[model samples]
Target: MTVELRVLPPLLVSLAVTVVLAACTRVPPPPPPESREGFPERGARLIQQYGCGGCHTVPRVPRAEGLVGPPLTRFGARSYIAGELPNNAENLRRWIQDPQSVEPGTAMPDLGVSETDARDIAAYLFTLE
Candidate 1:
């Protein structure tokens, strides 16, 4: 019993230290998929086609000045979507597909965006950084 108690304390301490150290270390997320490459250009075209400029002020997009919705100038650096969901590729795509679903009664209408188009749009949005 005495031997076990001494050994257990040291083992527990070592385990706790290991866990703390591991938690303190961070591993960066992997790079975006290769298939998403060359999508920004297409996404830019889609944005223009969708008339997104009618609502938000998008950088590099001509006549993308409006006061209805929030500006998407630094959209890529934003941390949240509609200030609700995390600003990731998947969430962005979902929001693009169905803004009402993500946030009911939102002014941003669902443009019936297809999955491929959503992905491309996301790629372009992330490029704003």
Candidate 2:
């Protein structure tokens, strides 16, 4: 009733280890394309008003070094939203406006962001690069 892994050679064991380590490592996604839809400056102010820094570690904004959520250092260069939705102006805006609609039970609460505010916030996020 004893199981033996001797059937697997040393080289196979090394290969398996290497594969597992590689899988555990995370590779940053390709940056999203640039666009000229929302206003970045306005978005920055809105970020402060929305208090997004309380959870996410956002750059530039004072006292925004929160560790509750992921750091938004190079958010503009990311390829996905909430690690699910495609990174685009519209999707970003939607997520900012109503995070609950995008992901149920997500820690990112819906802050009742107005459409205009969402657009501005998205614009500011895209400037993080």
In candidate 1, residue 29 scores what lDDT? 40
Q: Which sections of candidate 1 miss by over 4 Å?
A: 1-38
* All candidates: CA RMSD (Å): 6.5, 7.9
Q: For model 2, give the 10-residue run with minimal summed lDDT.
A: 1-10
Tens digit of per-residue lDDT, candidate 2, span 1-129: 123456557768899999999999988665584547878888888888888889988898877877888999999888989988988898998888888889998899889999988888888888888
TM-score, predicted candidate 2 vs. hidden true structure: 0.74
lDDT of each: 0.83, 0.84
